[model samples]
Target: MANVLIIGAGGVGQVVAHKCAQVPEVFEKITLASRTKSKCDKIAEMLPRKIDTAQVDADHVGEMVALIEKVKPDMVINVALPYQDLHIMDACLETGVHYLDTANYEPPEEAKFEYKWQWAYHEKFEKAGLMALLGSGFDPGVTSVFTAYAKKHHFDRIKTLDILDCNAGDHGLPFATNFNPEINIREITANGRYWENGEWVTTKPMEEKRVFDFPEGIGEKDIYLLYHEELESLSKHLPEIERARFWMTFSPNYLKHLEVLQNVGMTSIEPIEFQGQEIAPIQFLKALLPDPASLGPLTKGKTCIGNIIRGSKDGQEKIYYVYNICDHQECYKEVQSQAISYTTGVPAMIGAKMMLEGKWMKPGVWNMEQMDPDPFMADLNQYGLPWQETWLDKPFR
Candidate 1:
């Protein structure tokens, strides 16, 4: 059993709290905190079991450190924004607590989402004998584990990896992001990139597109290449992979609204003079959009995210695809959240379990694939997100 202090009360955070509460034997105590205390209290009220609530600005290291010192949790689960990752990690280190997060750290001024900033703390965490598990969400989390599971059980040598994320759900809104609008828009508008041979190949945003026949009836949707943080970690950990790419599907209506926003400068991150104050256009636009948490009840359909790995098993080339399909309504009925948050939150909770249970505990900064995947794969079936795998004779692309 462990006392977990979870920061951030967004959709993903709410799901994490609910899932963790479900497994009382593992999570003995839960404390949910965010900048908005009411949001934390709201989530705590929804759960049958009691969960402590607090208000702390995750961007401030002093406040986070104070909270850690007060609660002194065994670990901290960071579901806050990517910008606050380093601060939370610092707090964890100072208080002698382990750390885990769904996303990697990105500097506030730029939109880059690489793992270098977090990976730099490997030695410090190792010296302190504290473990930090990075990127425990859907694409970076489950997809990484799926690759490792494939490598251990299905392949002798892996050559290629394609992480496909498809969200076929509709929230009955004209245009709204499934997650944070700022992060979602910033990622899509940035240049598309993929790793091949040895180096990165960059292209115009959404420049390359392919139609993928998704399994479990999600069906043919257009997937576009994007540089996800997992590509860097996978390329480093799985050196045999010659080509690695990340793709996400978007609707035509989303593209149309995105184009209009870009044309009108609503998506730009650069600050502009506005009535004697400087503000980023994208931040302003985020306020005008609907909160992603509100879409839980309205969202309908399913999301299919997985990995397609190709390599040799017995001196002959082979292909395997492992993925999970989540229904939005099903998730809401269970956790009062949509599938996107459920998918990400379930893995976050499971990863925490792996660390707390010592199945994946090691004194260093590590990605999901670096650890043994058997226990995680089993937990996925037990805790909501059951996955399936299939052998492929033909190539996906």
Candidate 2:
């Protein structure tokens, strides 16, 4: 049993709180904190058991440190924004507590996100006898674990990897992002990148396009190539991987709205003077968009996110595929959130459990692939995001 302090009250944070509360044996006490305590309190009302809520600005190391001292939690689960990752990590280091986050850190002034920033803390964490886990979300979380699992059981050497993330749910809105609008828009508008022959290849936003037939009745959807942070860690950790790419599905309507928003400068991250004040257009746009939490009950259909890996086994070339299919309505029924939050949040809970249970505790910063995939994989099946595997005859084009 352990006490946990969760420092985000968005859709993902709600799912993490609910999932954590379900396993009282592992998460004995949970304190959900966010910038707005009301949001945390709202999520707390939905949980099976009562959890304490607090208001803390995770952007400030002082506020985070104070909260940790007050809560005295064994670990802090960060479902907060990517920009706050380091601040929370700093607090953990100061308080001598374990730390975990679903995404790597990215600078608030820049659109780029990578693992280099967080990876630098390994030496400090090791010296402090504290462990920090990064990128425990779905793609970075489950997808990275899937790669490690394949390398362990299915493949002796991994040659190529294509991570396909398809969210086919319809929220019935003209234009809305499944996650944070600013973060989502920044990632989509940024240049696309992939690794090949020990180098990175960059392309225009939404430049690379491919069609894939997803399993479990999701059918065919268009997937676009984008540089997700997982590719960086996977390539470094698995040196044998020659090529690794990440792809996501997007509808034409969504693309059209994004195009219009770009044309009007609504998606720009640069601050513009407005009424004697400066605000980024993207931030203003995020304010106009629907809160992602409200989309849970409105979303329908299913999501299929997994990896199509090509590698070798027993001196013979083979193709392997592993993925999980989650339904939006079903997730809402259980956790009051869509599959997007549920998928990301469930892995986060399991990751925290892995650390609390001492199955993955270590005195250093680590990625999902660096840990043993067996116990985490088993917990996935026992948890909400159950996965499936199949051997493919043809490679993903």
Candidate 3:
């Protein structure tokens, strides 16, 4: 049993709190803190076990360090914004506590996602005799683990990888992001990029489109190729990968609204002079949109995310697909969150469990794939996000 401190009180944080509470043998105590104390209190009230709540600005290293020192948690689970990753990591280092996050660091000014920033702290963590786990969320989390499992058991050489993420869930709102709005809009408006022949190929945002026949009767939907952070890490770690790409399905209505927002400059991240003050257009736009957490009750349908791997096994060509299907309504019933939060948060709790149990713990920064996938895979079945694997005659595309 361990005492864990969770930063960030968004939708993902709520799920993590609930899931952590469910496993008392692992997490004997939990502290859910955020910038807003009320949000933390709200989540604490919903959990079956007693969880402490506090207020801390995740972006401030000193604040986080003070909280860590006060709580004396064995580990810190950071579900805060991508920009705050380094700050929390620094706090963990100062306090000699293990660290884990679902997403990598992205600068507030620039819309970029990569593990380089976090990877640079390898020496710091190793010297401190602490561990930092990056990209433990669904795509970067379970998807990365899935590939590692494939390498261990299925493939001799992985040649191509297509990470298909489809969120067919409907929130019954015209324009609402499933996650954080600022992060969502910044990522969508950025360039589309993929790795091929040991080089990156860039295209216009959402330039590549295709129709994919998803598993478990989700049917065919249009998917757009975009630059996802996982591709960078996978390409680096799995050097044998010849080509890699990421695709996501977007609703027509969402696309239409995004197009209009882009045309009118509502999606711009650059600060503009407004009422004698500087404000980012996208941040202002986020204020107008529905809170992603509130959409859990209204969201319906499912999300299917997986990887289509084409490679050689036993000196013979082969293809395989591993995926997880999550229902939005079902997730809400269990955790009062949609599949988006549930998918990301469940793995986060599991990742912390892996560290606390000494299964994947080490004195350095690491990605999900760098660790063993078998134990993590087993826990997925034991937890909510159960996965399935099937052999494909050929690639889905």
CA-lDDT, candidates in order: 0.95, 0.96, 0.94
Residues 135-166, candidate 2: write the lDDT tens digits: 89998899999999999999999999999999
Per-residue lDDT over 1-397 for candidate 1, one digit per residue giving the tens place of the 0 to 100 score: 8999999999999999999999999999999999999999999999979999999999899999999988889999999999999999998998899999999999988989899999999999999999999999988899999999999999999999999999999999999999999999999999998889989999999999999989888889999998899999999999899999999999999999999999999999999999999999999999999999999999999999999999998898999999999999999999999999999999999999999999999998999999999999999999999999998889777
Rank all candidate structures by their lDDT, best first, as comma-separated numbers. Answer: 2, 1, 3
| Cα lDDT over the full model 3 | 0.94
Off by over 4 Å in 3: none
Residue 161, model 1, lDDT:
94
**Considering summed lDDT, which 10 consecutive residues are worst modelled in model 1?**
388-397
List pairs with backbone clashes in candidate 1.
none
- Pairs with backbone N, CA or C atoms under 3 Å apart (clashes), candidate 3: none
Predicted structure with the largest lDDT when compared to the true one: 2
RMSD over all Cα atoms, model 3: 0.7
Q: Each candidate's TM vs. the true structure?
A: 0.99, 0.99, 0.99
